[model samples]
Target: MDFSDTIGVSAAGMNAQSTRLRIAAENLANKDTTATTHGGDPYRRKTVTFKEELNRQTGVSSVKVKEIGQDQTPFEQRYDPAHPAADAKGYVKMPNVNSMVEIMDTHEAQHSYEANLNTMQITRSMLTRTINLMK
Candidate 1:
C-alpha cells in the first residue's frame, strides 16, 4: 500500500471519531434535560455507528458513519414536584445520558482521534522524507 493510502485511512478514522465526539458532547450537554410536557418522553442518548467503505479509485478501505441512533436505555425518574415536566406522581423523566459514561466515551474518542492524527502526521513525514531523498 502507498503512503497516501495510510493518510486516507487515518483521515477517515479521524472523521469518524470527530462525529462520535460531537455526539458524546451533545449527550453530555443534554443530560439534565427533561421533557417539556408532563408524561412526555425525555431526551434519548444518541449513538454513532461506523461502517467501512472501499475507495474504488485508490483501492483503500476507510470508515464512515453508518447512522446516529437513539439509546434504548430507559430514562431515570427524578423527584421534582415543582417542575412543569413532572408527572402526577411528582416524578420527572430525566434523560438517559449518564455523565460518567459520556465522559469515558469522550476520552476514548479523543484518544482515537489523536492516534489517527499521529498516523497521518507520520505518513506525511515519510512522504516528505522520500521526496527530499529523491531531490
Candidate 2:
C-alpha cells in the first residue's frame, strides 16, 4: 500500500476508536442515572460495533463503525425506599453501566486511538523523508 492508503486506514481506525471512547464516556456518565418514573427502565449501556470496508478504487481495507446499540444486559435493582423512582416494592431500577468496565473500555479505546495516531504520524514522516530524498 502507498502512503495515502496507510494514512487512510489509520484515520479510519482512529475514528472507530474515538467513537468507542465516546460511547464508554456516555455509559460512565449515565452510570447513576435512574429512571424518572417509578418502575420504568433505567439507562441501558451503549455498545459500539465495527465493520471492515474496502475502498474499491484504492484497494484498501479500513475499519468502520457498524452501529451503536444498547446492551442487552438487565438493569440492576437497588433498594431505595425514599427515592422518587422506587417501585411499590421499594426497589429502584439502576443503570446497567459498571464503572470498572467503563474505565477499562475507555483505557482500551484510548490505547487503540493512540496506536492509530502513531501509525498515521509514522506514515507521514516516511512520506516526508521520501520527498526530501527525491529533492
Candidate 3:
C-alpha cells in the first residue's frame, strides 16, 4: 500500500460526511418553515445518501454522496387553527422532519467526520516519522 493512500481515502470520507452533516442541518433548519408565497408548499425534509465508487487512479473504493434528495415520507399535520397556512379543518401541514431524529443523525455524521479527521492526522504523523527516520 502507498503511504499517501490513507490521506486520500480519509479526505474523501471527510468530504462525504461534511455533505451529510450539511443536509442534516438543512433539514433541521427548515423543520418548521411553512408556506409563505402563493401556491407554495411547506418546507420538506431533505435526506443524504452515500455510495461507494472506485477511485480511477488509486483503484480504491471511496464513499461519495450519491444524492441529496427530498424525503418521500408524508408531511406532518398539526392542529393549528390560528395559523395562516392552516387548513379549514384546523390542521396545518408541517415538515416531515423530527427534531430528535435530526439531532441523532447530526451526531452520527459528526462522529463520522471526526473519525476521518483522526485518520488523516494519524497518517500525517506516520509520514512525518517515516521521513525523520530517513534523515
Candidate 4:
C-alpha cells in the first residue's frame, strides 16, 4: 500500500483508540460517585463501541467509534445507612465501574494508539527515503 493509505488507516485507528481511552478515563474518574439525591441510581460504567470503514480516497480500511453506551448490569447496593444517596432500607447504590477492568481497558487503548502512531511514523520515514532516492 502507499504511504497515504498507511497514514489514513493509522489516523482512523488512533481516533478510535482515543475515544476508548476517553471513555475508560471517565469510568475511572466516576468509580466512587454515588447517587447525588436520595433514592437515585449511582454512576454506571460507560463502554465504547468501534466500527470499520473504507477510506474511499486512500482505499484503506479504518476504524471508527460507533457508539458510547451504558452498562446494563444492575447497580451494586451497599449497606450504608448514613450515605446521602441511601435508600429507605439504608442501602446505598454503588457505581458499577470496576477499577481493574477500567485500568486494563485504558492500557489496551493506549497501546493501540501507540501502535497507530508508530505505523504513521514508519510510513513517513519510508516515504521520505523514497523521495530522497528519486531526487
Candidate 5:
C-alpha cells in the first residue's frame, strides 16, 4: 500500500465529518422554528447518512455523504394560545430536533474531523522526512 493513500483516505473522512457538522448546525439553528401557518408542519430535524466508496486509483475505502434526510420522528406539541402557528386546540408544533442530541452529534463530528486532520499531518511529516533523507 502507498503511504500517500493514508492522507487521501483521511481527507475523505474529514470531508464527510464537515458535512455532518454542517447538518447538525442547521438542525440546531432550526430547533426553535415553528410553522408560520396554523396546522402546518414545522421544520423537521435533518440527518446525514454516510457511505463508503472504493477509490479506484488507490483501492482505498473512503467515506462520503450518502444523503441528508429529514428525521422521521414526530414533532413535539406545545400549548401556546397566543402563538400564530397554534392549531385549533391551541397547540404549536415544534421541530423534532433535540438540542442535547444535536450538541452530541456536533461534538462527534468535530472529534472525527480532528482525528482525520492528525492523520493527514502525520502522513505529510512522514513524506517530508523521506524526501529529506533522499537528498
Candidate 6:
C-alpha cells in the first residue's frame, strides 16, 4: 500500500477507537444510574463491536464499528431500603456497568487511538520526505 493508503487505514482505525472511547465514557457516566421504577431494569453496559470493511477502490481493509450493543450481564442487587427504586425486599437493582472495567476499556481505546494517530503522522512524514527528496 502507498502512503495515502496507510494514512487512510490509520484514520479508519482512529475513528473506530474514538467510537469505543465514547461508548466507554458513556458507560462510565451511567454507572451509577438506577432504575426509575422498582424491579425495572437499569442502564445496561454498552459494548462496541468492530467489523472489517473493505474499500473497493483502494483494495484496503479497515476497521468499522459493527454495532453498539447492550451487555446482557445481569445487574447487581444492593440493599438500599431508603432508595426510591428499592423493591419490596428493600433491594435495588444497580446498573451492570463496572467502573474498573470501563476505565480499562477507556485506557485501551486511548492507546489504540494514539497508535493509529502515530501511524498516520509517520506516514505523512514519510510522504513529505519523499516529496522533498524529489525536489
Error of 4 at 94 (Å): 0.5
Query: Which prediction has more favorable lDDT, 1 or 6?
Result: 1
Q: Write the per-residue lDDT of candidate 1 for residues 37-80, one digit (tens) a residue.
A: 87888899999999999989888899999999999989999999
Model 2 stretches with alpha carbons more than 4 Å out: none
Q: Rate the local accuracy (lDDT) of all candidates.
A: 0.94, 0.95, 0.85, 0.91, 0.93, 0.93
Best by TM-score: 2
Q: In candidate 2, how many Å is residue 83 off?
A: 1.4
Query: What's the distance in Å from true for residue 47, model 2?
Result: 0.3
- Residue 113 lDDT (model 5): 100
lDDT of 3 by residue, 1-135 (tens): 576778888998999989988888998888889875433468888888889989778778878889899888888888877887877686877888999999999899999999999989988999999999999
Q: Is candidate 2 or candidate 4 better by lDDT?
A: 2
The best-first sequence of candidates by TM-score reads 2, 5, 6, 1, 4, 3
Candidate 3 weakest ten by summed lDDT: 34-43
For model 6, how many clashes? 0
- For candidate 6, the 10 contiguous residues with the lowest summed lDDT are 34-43
Off by over 4 Å in 5: none
Across 1-135, the per-residue lDDT of candidate 6 in tens digits comes to 899899989999999999999999999999989988877888899999999999999899999999999999999999999888899999999999989999999999999999999999999999999999999
Candidate 4: give the clashing pairs: none
Task: Return the clash pairs for model 3, or none.
Answer: none
Worst 10 residues of 5 by lDDT: 1-10
Residue 7 miss distance in model 3 (angstroms): 0.6
lDDT score for residue 42 of model 5: 92
**TM-score for each of the candidates:** 0.95, 0.97, 0.92, 0.95, 0.96, 0.96
- For model 4, residues 1-135, the per-residue Cα lDDT tens digits are 778888988999999999999999999999989988898888999999988888676567789888999998888899999888888999999999999999999999999999999999999999999999999
| Model 2 per-residue lDDT tens digits across residues 14-56 | 9999999999999999999998987789899999999999999
- The C-alpha RMSD of each candidate to the native structure, in angstroms, is 1.0, 0.7, 1.5, 1.1, 0.9, 0.9
